[model samples]
Target chain A: MSTATFYDQVRTAVTNRVPVALATVVRGTSLGAKVLILPDEVQGRIGDDALTGQITLDARSLLRDERSETRPYELNGEPIEIFIESFPPPPLLVIFGAVHVAQPLSRLGKQLGFRVVVTDARSPLATAERFPDADEIIVAWPDDALTQIDIAPTTFIAILTHDPKFDEPALSGALTTEARYIGAVGSRKTNEDRRERLRAAGVDEAHLERLHAPIGLNIGGETPEEMAISILAEMIAVRHGRPGGQLSNAEGSIRGQVTSPVG
Target chain B: MNEWLPEIDQWRARGDQVALATVVKVEGSAPRPVGARMAVSSSGELAGSVSGGCVETDVFTAAQEVLASNEPKLLRYGITDEMAWDVGLACGGTIEVFVEPLSEPPGEKDRAR
Candidate 1:
């Protein structure tokens, strides 16, 4: 395929929020050649059929891991190197309240490369002017909005609607999804009462365990921006499977365990 | 790379040759992540970056050469005491950047997607 067509496929996959990988023969006789690999199909050609097949498999593996790396291979006794670059769609951050904290939280989410969506029932509160950083504004009930959007493992849901009428259904809807992180904002007693209400409403204990009520790391943050940072901290910790504790008290690598070659 | 789409399209629209430099592999504490990209135009204009202020000048020169030669080049940059005054990442990390010329875009209509 022509390079323009190859790039078009890559761009289309990325715009559609699909995981895609591009393998380039960076240090080979076929240098500048590329192959585009999606989950179900492959396009372009890095080299001959055998080499292209190998790169396609490797590209799929790297795409699944959301990693980019350079790997060395041998073609007819000659060393060849290929760079496999994976492009996973940006993670989704859904904020279910356009409150004071949501403003800074959405901004932080965008700064961190998340696609932020803010949803609220009150049209006046969920205006685009209030959330300049949010990629989407849904003026609908929090639970209804949650059900309407696509929530996958790459999604993080924050229920800031503290009222029972909203937070209850919001929590229920969030728990039903495969979202990686589901956090809610409330006081300790408020969370406890919220849990009781959820339990009475048939939300099982297993699902209740998934709720991060009284959300955010205990950073002693009182202002809206600081609270936003604390919430994002907790979300990041959850993303990396960390305990969200003080690094000074923690052992092992400050970056956590280096499990992959890319690190 | 998606972040540089508009700039790349503009360069192509202006009939300027474009070379894309991407950090394919990173070792140790690099400033940018693996997929970080920088685009250089034939007129010497640049957008995005593959490193901190440590090595863009060299990458720019290499990009111009790649654009002229129509060949892909893989470059490595790192810090060493011997090369302290040279172009190297001050963060003491190694990064492999691949520079290659991008073909002219299909057309403005195709770019809207």
Candidate 2:
């Protein structure tokens, strides 16, 4: 394919938030050749039949991991390197409650490249002015707003309403989705009472285990902004399957693998 | 690259030759992650960055060469390379950049037509 056509496809996929991968031959034979891998079809070609097939398989695996890297292959005493890059859609951070803490959380989420959506039943509270950094401000009930949004594996839900009316529904609705992190903000005593209510309402123990109650790392945060940082830190830790501990205490490299969330 | 799409598109629309330099591979304590990109227009305009203000100048020069030659070039930068040290990639990391021309060379446009 021509370079213009190849880039056009990339622009379309990226603008629409579709997951796509591009494989380019950076070294050895047929340098500069590219293959664009989409969910349903493959475009362009890397090289000859055998080499192209191998690159396609590797690119597909990297796409699954949402990773980008270069791999070297030895062919007939020649060293070939292909760079496979995956462009996954930005992760979503849904805040269910336009509380004071949500303001900072939404801002931080946007800075981290998340599509922040702040939703609340109170129309006055969930305004664009309040959450200038939020990508969306939906003035609707938690369940209603969440049901409309596509909650994929890259989605994170933060329920900040300490009130049972909104928190219970928000937790229940968020648990049904494939959100990577589902954190509920409340006190330890409040969480126990909330858990009992959820259990009485038929939320199973297995599902209850998925919830991060009294959310965020124990950073001893007192103010709303500090609380936002604590919550976001925990969300990042859960996303990477880390225990939210200090790097000095943690083993292995500073850059760790992003394990798929069991939640 | 994704963030610089509009700027790159404007450069293309204005008929200026464009080259894309991407960090395809990185090791050790690299400043930027893989897939970080730097775009260079033939008019000397630059967009985005692949490193923490360390190697962009050299990458821009390399990108101009790619735009002129219309051939992809693989460049390596690390502490092992004296130029990298001079350029201030002091993070003790190795990065491999793939520079490719996004527009056809001026000579090729006539031949294709």
Candidate 3:
């Protein structure tokens, strides 16, 4: 395929939030040949048919984890190197409330490459002017708003609305999805009360366990911005499957563990 | 690479010969992850970066050669302890970057149209 066409496919997939992978032959014969792999289709070619088949399988596996790496493959007894680069859609940050904390949280989330969306029942409060950095501002009830969004494993839900009217429904809606991180803003007593109310509402203990109540790392944050920072920190920790504690106290390297190469 | 698409497209529109360098393999510590790209134009203009400024100059020079020869090359950079002290990687690591000329020069597309 032409380079223009290859770029067009990539641009469309990325803009439309589709998961895709681009495999490039980095070494051996036909270096620089590329194959673009989508969920349902494969575009372009990476030279040899046998090599392409093997790379496609590897690309699909790497796409699941949104990883990019180089792997060695034997094509007709000759070893070749292919770089499989997975391009997952940007992570989603759905803020349930458009409160003061939501403002900074949305901004911080955007800065960190998340597609931030702020939803609230109050139309005036969920205005675009209030959340300039947010990719979307929906003026709808929590459950209804969430129904319109595709919450997957890369989604982060933050229920910042302290009011039971909004927070309860928000938490309930968030629990139904496969969101990776779900945090609710409230005090310790408030969290306990919210948990009791959720239990009364038929939310099981297992689902309640997913909630990060009294949200954020205990950084003694008082202002809205500071609270926003704390909340984002906790969300990041949860996303990386890490305990929100001092890094200095950790024994291993600060960086994440690297994945071993696949033969 | 996706982040640098807009600029790369602009360069293509301008009909400038361009070369793309992508980090294919990284050993040990790496500033940027695999799939990171750096695009260089014939005019020496550049966008994005494969390294955190430690190896861009060398990559840019190599990119120029790829553009001139119309050939692709895989370049490797291994930062040593002394090099790390001058450059800013916390630890020494090796990175392999593949540089290739674009399939079509930017101006050629416009001419074809």
Candidate 4:
């Protein structure tokens, strides 16, 4: 889209769930211009075909992950004097339960700028009225809801369908996808029990470890919101490769912004 | 830039001439990312940010020159291993920034046609 309406339309499209891409001149002679691109056409310009063609190709790759960045290139179709910065909104968070904890977890996730989707098999529990703050609340099985959308590495998946029958297929589907985080809510005994079931179901040990089964840092959380905080904390820890344990149990300096929430 | 549309539009509706600067790259632990950007108007109004804060002053200075000369320039800052340490990031990050003056198209003064 042209620079004029690019922000308005993109903001509305993103807040309304329409996929889009943004290409901007991040460097070179034409440093401050931009265009918005959907799957079909464009809303802005970067001179002409040679530069636009190259940037369109790059925009396609970033489109899948909905990423934003500064990418440099040449200008006048021959000299290097242009940069295309792409913005594709933010990725999504698909949670497979509307349990007591899902409320705060989804709330906190929204605060961090994630488009949260809370799903459940029970209609009463999955109503939008219950999750007034979530981006979407679907009253459907996890697999059915997930089948309708493509998953990205920026996506986060949670299996709070405490029951084994629901959590199994739910966990199975999430593990097979490219989501950056896959966590399940449970306990030590519950973790061992689930591991046995997943192993029996042909899941390998390596893949199974990827599942954060007790699903949170050891914060001794005793309530839904507290547990949500611990789970979010552990998710943060995993994203940055920090040890997910009590401060007394960890080592080395903690690094980077505490609120990045990126995986 | 489209990135500043929300702020730029608000400023433009009030008759502003905006200048822009973008951080194209970082050689070390720079606070801002490669695509970071900031915009300024002829009347000293500003929006967005390239560095979290440390390098914006330098960018503003460069933007003033771009506005005066109407010429884009690639300026480099933050050299490590220098005891003089002028205009360098304390975090020891090196950065490259491009500053330019944004102008209206021909026959499009009143409206950005």
Most accurate candidate by TM-score: 3
Off by over 4 Å in 4: A6-37, A42-48, A58-73, A76-79, A122-130, A141-154, A161-166, A176-178, A199-209, A217-230, A233-263, B1-22, B36-49, B57-76, B79-87, B97-113
Q: Which candidate is the best by DockQ?
A: 1
Query: Of 1 and 4, which scores higher on DockQ?
Result: 1
Q: Please say which candidate is ahead in lDDT: 1 or 4.
A: 1
lDDT at residue A51 of model 2 (Cα atoms)? 74
TM-score of chain B, candidate 2?
0.84
lDDT of 1 by residue, A163-221 (tens): 88888888987897899999999999999999999999999999999998799999988
Return the clash pairs for model 2, or none. none
Candidate 1: where is the Cα deviation over 4 Å?
A1-5, A244-258, A261-263, B1-6, B105-113
TM-scores of chain A across the candidates, in order, are: 0.90, 0.88, 0.90, 0.74
| CAPRI tier for the interface of model 4 | incorrect
* Candidate 3 chain A minimal-lDDT segment of 10 residues: A254-263
CA lDDT, every model vs. true structure: 0.84, 0.83, 0.83, 0.71
The sequence of per-residue lDDT tens digits that candidate 2 reaches over residues B32-101 is 7788888999899999888888889989999988988888899888876556437746777888889998
Regarding lDDT, does 2 or 4 come out ahead?
Answer: 2
| The 10-residue segment with the lowest total lDDT in model 4 chain A | A254-263
Candidate 3 colliding pairs: B15-B106, B15-B107
lDDT, residue A136, candidate 1: 94
Q: Which structure is stronger by DockQ: 3 or 4?
A: 3
Model 2 chain A lowest lDDT segment of ten: A254-263
DockQ of 2: 0.34
